[model samples]
Target: MSLDYDLVIIGNSLEASYAAVKAAKLRARVALVLGETETNTYTEIDRSTFNCLTYLDKKGQNLTQWELNYDFVTHLNSSQIQTWITQVKQDIKEYYSPAILADLGIDIIGESGEFCRLPALGFVIKNRTLRSRNYLLAMGSISSIPKIEGLSELGYLTLETLDLENLPYDLIILSQTPIGIELAQSLNHLGKKVTLVVEDSNILPQEDAEAVQLIQAQLEAEGIKLLVNCPITQVRKIEDKKWIQAGNEALETDEIILITKPTPNIKGLNLEGVKVEVQPQQIIVNDKLQTTNPKIYACGSIIGGYSLSNLAKYEANIVIKNAIFYSIFQVNYHPLPFHIFTHPILSRVGLTETQARQSYGDDIIIIKQNYKTLAKAQILDETTGFCKIITRRNGIILGGHIIGNNSDELINFIALSIKNNIKIQQFSQLFPSYYTISEILFQISENWQYQKLQENKFLNNWLETLLFWRRRWKL
Candidate 1:
């Protein structure tokens, strides 16, 4: 039996569609198993709304405190925002539509399918069998709602089912992920009293503590109650009000939102039958991203962790190389950056301070710089965060954590540096535009140099001796 496609991507998520289009552009015979498309329409709207709120917040205009029913910054109400979101969603659907994809030389099959090991390995959808040389699973994950007493019957909202038009006055959010932190802030800005309950000791345990604290303080200042290390024991609906018993506290709210961990969408895929190792939350894959069955590969949310689009795309690129050709490419997430879209956004790359210290011991150096010290931050009145960089004694950047305005863009500079194995010394020689936020990197690098010099007593003495000789010579 001849192979029908070089690659058959399973799932209708944006990541799956993107992989299909990329494979097609590479001239590979690709087919997309289009199920109900998982559009990120609301996510984009929420981000846009947050940006508007951010502008007002920076302007020192407490719109929420003003009790403004309408967003003066965007000049739009909730109903108008929904209308715009619908149009945007329509546009996105058309862009990734089966017709458009088919025109791009991607065989878009609008049917759900499952892997079959018999009659040769292939995916079966209705009467048709898709036999591909290799298969890629980009099936995105779903919000893994926690198992709490009376929660299912009490009714709650997840990101997938959130309604922006009908937001509650008070809400309880159960999560510890970046999305959870972001939602808490965004909703708080929109005049909703948000109580964030986290099961972990700290939010973003993977990031630098100092950077995370800055964001945490900002959230508290904005009046969003944070209940760390609090696990929900039960949920109940007392008449029209919702009551949550988390840890030692019993909280009341108008609604409850769950942004818990994501469970991979592999239930109907028959992965076990196909000999693909499956975990409760993720699919097991090797460094090469090859599943237990080498003929099949998986990426995106199904692999677990953050489920970031950027990280998924990175894995997808590696999968493409291995599937399309005999390549030894393995996915490396060390240089990849992840960010939270809070007011003073948090972005980080590579190992955090604790991780670096654990691996490198006390030989690692920590460099810190404040956003307020930068002229750019002062001019913009957005100086509420700092940058923390961890490097080996040799100046090799082990990690970088930034919390401030434009940290998302700034962290990329460090990510690119780390990817190219560029040392922190290289940044010291850089002359970023004087009145730019990027100057913060240059300043941080200089601090690293000063710290190194301070650690070298002999060099410091030699510099002092040289200055004394120059003074005595009186040239």
Candidate 2:
């Protein structure tokens, strides 16, 4: 059967546009179907607001705690940010102009898309019907609004549709992700009474116990009320405020914000018409980013497992190889570090301790080192969390978890170590520069050896074996 385009991407997600570029680069006839009707909300924030600028005091280490009057929020102009986002969106569209893409043997579709099978396996977007050999579904996801009894009827705040100018006196944040927790604390620091509600037993359901415990402590210390393992039974308006019935407790709040997991955006695509298998929450995709149907491929929110834009782009490349080139490129989800951008960030690489125990049994070695022990942390007065590294009984590193000032960046080294099959004993030699957050990695690695020496001769035995082999590398 003849096809209109070689590759067709549906949806306006950044990943969708990026996949179009990748496909065009690979010398394929690409067509992107997107709705330019609505403003792109994801990139609405100014780039400068994201760049971290730290204020240093005497001796050049102590962080200056500045908010309202001196923080980045003080400089945020809603109108300017919106303008920038609009400009960026236009830039993306123009950069991949039809004329430019035509030179690369690609086409374009600017409308809503749906799959049809009657005439042929194709996408019908408004007036134009496009037939493609393969389809890359980079359609992003929507906010997972839980099935609260009266939530739909009585309106609530979502991260996407939040109004910053209209501040509520007391806010109830129903959340399940780290972004929710970060917002809770951040809004609290902004002088709002905030209560965070988590359906799970603890904050960060997927994080290590130690990281969770530390973050939970810090959240409480920051005066953010946590209602853990508690979900709303009913929501209704009580004159000026909103009343919530949550697990035998009644609470009243000025407004409610939902920060839940992202539900896949596969609606109206008529996926069932094409025999594509989709879960209630997400579309089922294999490691290679291929859907249940060989001709259909997916990434981004539809595939689930990730919420970050970068992860979606990574998945998009995998789909390009598997769907376009007929090559196998799998995602190593584990050893993929994640960070919650809270004041004291929470980050983890590889498996959680619970996950490690489940996979390797109870024989896995565990070592924990606190940022409080580091002079750099003391100098900065940012000693609120610790780093925990897990390894095998024979000295192979398994996983790492960090919750501290620089936990976000610190987790990367641990992730690389796990990815490269580097062991804990070898980490001590991987020293970072003096008086830095990275030194914690080297200290923890040295501590791992000490712990092993006290508990077992695991480190010594590995060293003896290395000496016996006399294996030396010329680096």
Candidate 3:
């Protein structure tokens, strides 16, 4: 069969739309299959709303310091919040409108479709068959629902379907994921009593334990109830009130939210016919981002890791190249940084301390600097966390975990060092401006140098002898 296009991207996800636009820009004949359902749009909007609300709430406390006499109320009425949501939705729609995409030479298919295998592999939607040299699966993710008895009957809220404008007074959120924690914090700040239930021993199990503990502490300090290592056994609705049997405690709340790891939306696409292997949570792909069927490639939330659009776009870049041309390029996530957008953001890149120890043994070095020590942090009155840099004994930066104001920005410096194979010692040579948060990097590098000096007894003795000789000669 003659190919209909060079690439056929399946799904209406932001990642899919982005790939389509990029492929078109590359001058490849691209067709975007936007199914009836909308994916990731609402989730993105909710995330943006969370960030905006958090920023306003934090800034409200410093109104007097800024010499502003206005009282800042971060809370918005239901209709006002809905209006904001509508405007955001409209803006996103305009940005990715089919008409705009068509101008770039992309075929926009609005109907839902499934993969067909018998009559030469192609996607079938109504009367049309979208045949291409390569297929890209960019289907977005859906919230993973647990198998708790009575929970399905109770019908909990997911991030995509959450009604922030009409949030309940009390919430029992069942999740340990970063998005879950972010939502819990945002809702708590909005005057909602949030009880965050984590099935794991700690939140963000992949992150540094100390940093995770600090975030937990911050949440608790803000009156958010946190239940670690506690799993919900059952949930039942009782006369407009919901009761949850979590671990040993039976907690009552007005609503329950499930914010577990997201599952990819691959149903009805007939991936089995196309020989695509899929786990319960993600689609299986190789380093080249190719599915089991080499002709098919997948990216974004479907392949699974974190539902970060920037990471997804990075993957899309690699996928587009290999799909349109020879499959030589592979996706690299080592340099990319991810962060939870909570107050005193928890951002990280590269390996954690445990991973470094597992890989390099005890020969590695760990350097920590408190945010409170930074003049910028003190001046900003936002010194609630610290930065931990994990490095090899030779000072090669392996990873960085930070929990503090602008941690999202600070982590990038470490990410760049790791990406470029730059040593931690080089950070000391950098001259950051006075009273800046970036000084933490210099302090951490110096701390590493000081640690090495302390550990080197021979060097210490040499310094002591030189000092004594110089004193005796009065030089």
Candidate 4:
């Protein structure tokens, strides 16, 4: 069958860009339909830098009596941060422009695309109908706005509308999304009264309790109030204040933000008409990242989760491999860390403490490393969080969860250890670096081995006997 292109990508998101570049490099004819999807890749960085500013501000308050550079952090504001974000966004857009993709031999379609038929499939973009053997649905997701009373007429804000001036002085954030918590902290740091409404007991229910609790303490210390186990039932405008009936209280705030889950943007693709299986929230795909329609595939937010660029890039590669090479490769993300960019940052990989306990029961051993013990954290006045590592009784690592500055970087080493099945005793005890967070892992690894050896009666007796024998022989 003579097809128009080898593949037709249906969005201009990070996943779409990744597919376009890889397909182009593979010498396969590819068409990227930008369509009506407007993308903003700087959202993560924008969220992260605000926390960075907050950290800097805290540091300035603690150490400005002596350090000159630390005193300057007080002058930072939202306007300056926005300008930096705009400049970076411009640089990134130019680097990944449609013209650049075209130079790399990819057909860039400015118009929207719709599926024409199934089994023998093709995408119709305006006057052109590009036929392809396979399709990659990287269109991402639309914000799944909830059906709250007076929410539509009264109006509300979201993670998207952060640039507007005259934003609410007192903001009420609905949930604990990565963006929601980050926005809460940033807005609070920017002089707004931010209240995070968590329906559960913990702020970040997906993470380990210890880590989540530490981050919660940090948030509270920074003046961002957390309203846990408080679910909002109704939202309405009372004169000038936005009021919400949450739990037993009728809380009033200047603005209300619903951090609702995002649903896949598969409505226009007409998947049901073509018999492509889709669940309530996302398109149904197998471990190989293939949809019910073998000729089609989906990734990123279209699969229904947080819209993270790294996850998008990872899933896109999985799609490309299974779709192009005809290989069955299940998506393996065990080693990839799930990070939340809160004030001190939180990162986790593999099984959490609870999950490890459930899986290994009494065989699990938890080793905790405090940031207060690290010279780097003490030097930077970031001695507020800790790293909790879970492992088998005999020292095989099961998980790593950290909450602190540079924790995002420190968790990667433990993730690698878990991925490669490295034992705590097997890891070398030589950490020559001083005043660095990396030493925490080395210190904890040594402690795990020494404690296990010392606690075991048989091992300790055997070592003692060996030492006595060696002394007697004098060899």
Q: Pick the candidate with the highest lDDT.
A: 3
User: Which regions of candidate 4 deviate over 4 angstroms?
Assistant: 37-42, 61-71, 465-475
TM-score versus the correct structure, for each prediction: 0.92, 0.84, 0.93, 0.92
After superposition, which runs of candidate 3 have C-alpha atoms over 4 Å from their true positions? 40-45, 61-82, 467-475
Which pairs of residues clash in candidate 3, taking residues 3 or more apart in a chain or in different chains? none
Worst 10 residues of 1 by lDDT: 36-45
Which pairs in model 2 have colliding backbones? Answer: none
Tens digit of per-residue lDDT, candidate 4, span 1-475: 5888778888867679888898889888888988775754335556666667665655565566566755245655667767766776667768679889999999888887678774567787777778986899987665667776778888887666655355758888987456678778877767788888877766777788888777788789888878889866788887888898888988889888777666676667777765689876688887878888878888887786666777788898888777777858789877777678887888888888888888888998888889899999988777888888888997888888898879888777777788888887665566648988888888788878777877899989998999999999994
RMSD of 4: 2.5
Worst 10 residues of 2 by lDDT: 50-59
Q: Give the TM-score of candidate 4.
A: 0.92
Give the Cα error of residue 433 in candidate 4, in Å.
Answer: 0.8
Query: How do the residues 6-101 of candidate 3 rate in per-residue lDDT, one tens digit apiece?
Result: 999998877888999999998999999998866653465567666765667656756655767776534455456567767877788688898999
CA error at residue 57 for candidate 2, angstroms: 15
Candidate 2 segments whose C-alpha is farther than 4 A from its true place: 39-106, 455-475
Residue 182: error of model 2 in Å?
2.0
C-alpha local distance difference test of each model: 0.83, 0.74, 0.86, 0.78
Model 1 lDDT on a 0 to 1 scale: 0.83
